[model samples]
Each structure stands twice: as structure tokens, then as C-alpha cells.
Target chain A: MNRLFKKYEGKLPLKVINDIKEKLPKKISEAKLKKILEEVVMEYNKMLVQPGESVGLVSAESIGEPGTQMTLNTFHFAGVAEMNITMGLPRIIEILDGKKTIETPMTEIYLKKPYSQGKNIKKLALSIKETKLNEIVSEFMVNIAESKIELRVDEKRMESIGVNYPVIQKCIKASFKELALSKKGDSIILKLSEKEKELNQLFKVKEKIKEVYIQGIKGITQVLPIKKGSEFLIITAGTNLKKVLELDFVDKTRTISNNIFEIASVLGIEAARQAIINEVFKVIQNQGLNVDIRHLMLVADTMCATGTIKGVTRYGVVKEKASVLARASFETPIKHIFNASLIGEVDHLNSVVENVMLNQPVPVGTGLPGLVTKVKREPEWLKNKH
Target chain B: MKNINVKKHMLVPEHSKLTKKEIQELLEEYNLSLNELPKIVSTDPAIERFNVKLGDVIKIIRDSPTAGKSIYYRVVING
Candidate 1:
């Protein structure tokens, strides 16, 4: 555990990030490995556009004078299909990789506004609904109708309509779960195509599989992909952790590590670290340590994370500068034993971490060598002895 | 007086705060004055149907939730 922590607990330099990539084991079967790295890169991109987060944009005052924050309404990702929502990811990666899916299919919806300057305040609040939003729209309409207000369709929109219904085409191209219903005023009645029916059937099967998979892994919440060649699957078993301990006398450590790695590939390293923390707890809990679970939590945390496990104070899991508050959340204590064991240097931990947010630097195998050097000097003295 | 009796609440589009010149321009563009359009309060619930500025004349778009493109617009009153 110390060795594992030692390997990661500092800011990995750019050279190191490259070195890790270079040292990465290569083989034909390791196409999965390359895919994993690509996914990691993708995760980084997702982090970039993470909403409501501060980003380094040129200050408006310096450029075009101050205006209100461009707080436009987010459209429910204009996706009729779950996969085409990949459009954003694809666009991001294309730019990153210097390859473009420029011709990748897109549907356009034209609102009744001129493209000129002014109150573009009417943002497209929704692109489309994933969970039968037509019902919600119907409810809203019902409310308006209840007031005895007459509703009418915008004739001018139909008159000026130039673009083919890109949204409709995209919906049809998607997994075809769209339900066409008759309305009172629509002169153009669109019938659901046969291809659309097949898609809907597929959606039903997908949903059923999800239900079965979720039911199967209720208790043991390790991600287990349904298929060998698939992406990450968070295995949630209804059975107890005590059951996992009973699994055929397999190489328990290796099996756990492999699962952690699998989760990391699909989800990312933070999740992998979580898997490591959770699995360790389950294993030791089965061992039935007389020490508090919170103490074991600190130890497991000191192993899985950069900082040592301090007591869970009213301020919560105090993380060191080398550690992160964002990832501190991974150590979710069971039963809400809010107050518990205290370990590690509190003052030094504070210097490394400020109030909730770490001020100095993340200990991802980089500069702040204090934690890494400590682990390296100690070198798994207690962990490996067993 | 045999014309349709437009309800007072239906005139939610009449809450213009535009300057006399700007309001006059808008009125002329739509071919109307304060007397022609029905009076509506800015607080009227139906005024939310469109986004119009003070003195801006909006043309309330009625849309069918289902089926083909059917949209019509009327002014929303703004204070």
C-alpha cells in the first residue's frame, strides 16, 4: 500500500506524464490499453468545459467592453440518441488529435429570431427530452389551457422556415424511441417509420439489461462490465461484502487490482483510487478488526491517498496540500460516524491544504516531495511484512 | 362593436416603457397606437409566452406541441 502511494503521491511533471506514456507496456492485445489512455484524455476534456467552473477567458473589459455574463440556458443536449451526444466529445477529440469528423451528422433548429445583434435572451432551454419530456410539455400546456386561454401555432415560423427539420431527422437517425402522436392542428401527420420501431425495440432491450445488471450487483458495488470487451461497468451486487470474501480462493489481491484498473480505464484514476479504497475496506472489514472502522479508514486513506487519515472533525476529512479536497469526497464514511479517530499532523496538513481547497499543489508524484519521500523512506514496512 | 371582444388580460403586450420617440417608431412600424392594442399588465401570466423589451412590439407565437410546424406570434407586454 505504501509503495502504491509512493508511486503516485506527487505532481507528475509533464516529462513524467510523457514518461508514463512511454513506459506503458505495448502489445497487439493492448489496443484496449491505448483506448484507455484515449479515454483518460477525453476525461481531461470534460473537465475543461465543466459548467459553472472558472475558466481563463480574455477579460471582456480588455476586449469588447463589459456585458452580462453569457449565462445562456443550456439546451438539453440536442441529442435524440444517447450516443450522438458523443458529438461534443468527438468535436473536442478531433481538435485534440488534429483529425475532424467535420461532416458528422448535425440537425439544426431555427428559432424565430434574426441573427443580428440584440436580445438573444430567449435561449434554447431544451434541445430534446431524454425521459419522455413530451409529458411535461403536455402538463405545461394543460395548465395554460385550464386558464381558458386559447393556444395557436406560430404561422410566421412555418412561412420563413428554410432549414429542413434537422431535429426530426436527427431523432429518426437516433435509436428511434420517438412516439408520434396526433395533435389537433398539425396538418402534416408524420408516421413513425419501420426503422424507428426496430430502434424502439432495441431501447427496450437496453433498458431491461440495465435493470437486470443493476439488480444483480446490489450489494457489491464494484463496476463489472457485462461483457469482456466492453467499457467500465460499476458492479453493484445485492449480496454482501461477506459474499465477495467467499468467492473461490482466487488471487484476491490481483483480482482486486485488475478490477480497479478496469474501472480506471473507463472512469478515470480518481474512480480507480476509490475502487482501491472501497475494496481495501471490504477486505479488512471481513477480517473484523477491533479498531474503529474510521481508524481503518484513515489507514486505507493514507494508503489510497496522499495524506494520512486524520480524524473526521466537524470540518470533515482534513486533507493535506499534497492531497485534494475534491477527491477527499471519495472517502465516504459509512453510517455517518461524523466524529471519529484523528491521526497525522494537523498543522502541517493545514499548510498543505487551505480551508477545504488545497492551496499549494496536488501531490500527484510531482514537486511536493514530502509525502512521496516519506513513503519511499518507509517503503511498505508494515504493509509488506504481512 | 361587433368585433371580437379582446380580453384585458390578453393585452399583456401593452406594458411598453419605451421613450415617446421609440414607442412611436414601434407603433408606426406595426401600424397602431396605444388605443388600438388592448391594455395588458406586465404581471400578466401569459406575458411570459414571449420575450419582448420595453416598447418592443412582439408578433405571441401559438405552437402545437405535437405534429408539424405551426407557430403564430403576438406582442407580449413589457414594463
Candidate 2:
């Protein structure tokens, strides 16, 4: 019963679950589970707010060797900087083609380190450029040219619009270091590293991406950041920017012609202000919004930028911190049970969760002694009385 | 406590030490907070983390090459 936290190491702490359940005031019903987990999430958010403002994902710092004394005063913004792995092009293709199950589905988390923006924006931007929508289309155009002219952008609209799955996959590719790559001819291969495959089995594939033809590129500005306000619709996938331009009211030259972004623009000013956010929304939807949606979007955008989905935290985004032994023997609280079973203390479970909850140091690896009960130090008010 | 100047709130702890009276008045006369005061010792925990003041001001200074200098405020943690 104590052997569940590991497929790799078999540190199963199922006994700890039993110990925690006893401590829990309520039964394990759906509503109760939801409430407790939501508490866990809300607590996580509160720790992130700084004095001035909650730092947003766009971390941009201009000039110097990075953060020179004078530079801290600049518009120092940071984009979501976490790393996780996606199902690589080949694996995604396999998933798309129905060759694999989402056993340990990949999800990501992200948090910004205090000053990494000064360290690597140029590399991050280069990685971002590699995911450019047009560049993806150019590749498709190239592949199609060698085979058929009918497939170019605007030629079929499908070639230019929708999910841009290939680019999304490439974005995932370019953002993170490939821990594993295996090629066996026409089937290029890839395997996610432990860091990349963190939320293994946490995502659900919602929609099978369908390719759409490009209506032609339009200026991004041509489309007002209005939601569902258009009189016409050309996109069978995203809003039809080409069709919208065809409208007498919208002057065509001012809008961007890429169909996916156009549809994103149609989604609203909030969505259009940053095209990446819109895609993130879709990825979370595809995966299922079991956790906080903002966390999902945060994780997804970080992945879009970094290519892996781990819950974001200050030091870095977590990729794959899977404790397989815990999952298998989850009949009861493994940590508590282990401490009880071995060290004779039922406190380990709460201690682990508490450490994780506070974003403080957590017990690791061989250090996790089977089971335990009770908490160590609850923060005390410095002064006892007035 | 009643005489505590509003501009000096960023300074002084629930800070264990009292600032020399002259520095406190000098800070208030300038209408500038402690953050404007140059950083001296950095060993203080409040200075390093919360940027609170014992005799320090987390003043706002805006210095950017492109936008030029603009005034901003900060909880000067160090000096």
C-alpha cells in the first residue's frame, strides 16, 4: 500500500492518503474535492502578487548587459517563461492519426524567475520567430508546390488559416531543448524529457485540427477588435478575414489577412491584443478546463513560447515531475501511510502538501520516508498579546 | 505616532531603529521620500526584501534612454 508514488522509483505513498483522509473533515465527494483543490489554487495565486502590480507574462527589458541600474526603470515586462514538452510533430501526428493514447497527457506550468528577462529575451524572440504563422504557411506552400499549386495560401484558404497546427507544433519544438529525438526515415521521431512530460495524462484532445484555406493576408488593423459583430463569416474555421474584407464596410488594406489571427481578432479586442493568448485559450479548451483556466492559459502560453507545460513558479516552469509510484497505489494517502508505516509518524502527507502549498522547500526523492502524521511548524504571530 | 509625517511612511520600521532626527527632517523638507536618499548599508532584511526603511526611502526614479527621465516611486529597500 505504501508503494504508489513511483513507476520509476516506486516510492508509493498510498498509506499517506489514508492518513490524510482521516484528517480531512469531509468525505471524498465531487464537490468536496473541487472545493479543497480550488483552495489549493487560490492560495497559489495570492503568493504571486508583488507590491506594484502582478507581473504579467510579457517580460520585456530594453538595453544594457541586461537590467543595468538605469534599466530597471524601463518597461521591464516578462512573457510567460516556463518550459514543458509537447507531443512532438511525429507524436502529435501519431496522436492525431490515432496511434497512441494520452497516457500521462502532457501539461505545463510556468512562473517567472525574478530577473531572467535580462538573460535571454533575444534567444526567446528568435525561438518565437521560428513559430511565425507565415513561415509555417511558406513550408506548406513549399510542400504543396512540389506536389500541387492548388494548395497555396488564398488558393484554398484552408492552406492559410485555422489552428496552424504545424506551426503550433513547431512553436513547441523551437521553444524547448529536445531531450529526445529519434528519426527512422519518413517518420521523424521525438520523445519528451522528464521535465517536458510533467502533467502526463492530464490533458484531453478536444478537436482534431482541420486544415483551412487562406483567404489571403489582410492587415491586422483592418479587423476591429469586435466580437461576433461581423455581418458576414468566411471562416469555416476562424472568422473569415477574406470575407470580412470583401464586406463593403471594412477597408481591406488595414487588416491582416491570416485567417487564424483574423478569427482571433473577431473574438474581441481582448483576444486580438495578443494573438498568442487566443491560441492558449483554445489549447486549454482542448485539454479540458479541470484546473483554473488562467493557470491553464498561463501554462499553455508558456508552452507556446517554451514548448512544455508545467505549472509556472518563480524558479521556472515545471515540465515532468511525475511520481508514478504514488498513482498506482493511490488507494489511500501514500505519504502519511508511509510515514506511519516506516517512520511511525502520520505527518509527512500534510508536510509535503504544506511545503508545496507555501512554495517553500519540499521533501524530495529518497528523502520521502513512507508515511507520517501531524504538521511541524505553523507560522506563529510574533507578538503573543497587545 | 501622531506626529509621524505621511511622506516618511516608507521609512521607519515597525523598523526596530529610530532614524537620527536631522535625517528625518531633511527627508521631509525636500518633499522627497527616503527612496531619494542614497543607499548606505544593505545588510538590513527590510531593505533587502520589503525595501522598507529604518532611515531609507524607496523613492521612485524613472531613468530610461528612449523615454527620457520621468519621476516614479519605489520602496527603496537598500539605502
What stretches of model 2 exceed 4 Å from their correct place? A1-230, A236-273, A286-290, A300-386, B1-79
User: Compared with the true structure, what per-residue lDDT tens digits does model 2 show for residues B2-77?
Assistant: 2212122211112223245745665676687664443323333223344444544333322222223222222223
Which ranges of candidate 1 are over 4 A from the true structure?
A: A1-225, A230-236, A249-315, A319-386, B1-79
Global lDDT of each candidate: 0.31, 0.30
Each candidate's iRMS in angstroms?
Answer: 32.7, 24.5
> Using TM-score as the measure, which candidate wins?
2
TM-score of each: 0.16, 0.18
Could you give candidate 1's per-residue lDDT for residues A1-386 as a string of tens digits?
22332343232223334544576666434456545545655664565434432221222121112112222222233323222222222222222222212223221111222311212311211111111212112121211112211113233432222212333233323533443423345221223434544545534533332222111112332222121232221222122222232233211222222243333332222333344444434433333422233333233233323211122232333332233333244454432223222333233342222333545663332333443333455557777897
Instruction: Please estimate how well model 2 matches the true structure, expressed as its whole-model Cα lDDT.
Output: 0.30
Error of 2 at A338 (Å): 36
Task: State each model's C-alpha RMSD to the native.
Answer: 33.1, 26.6
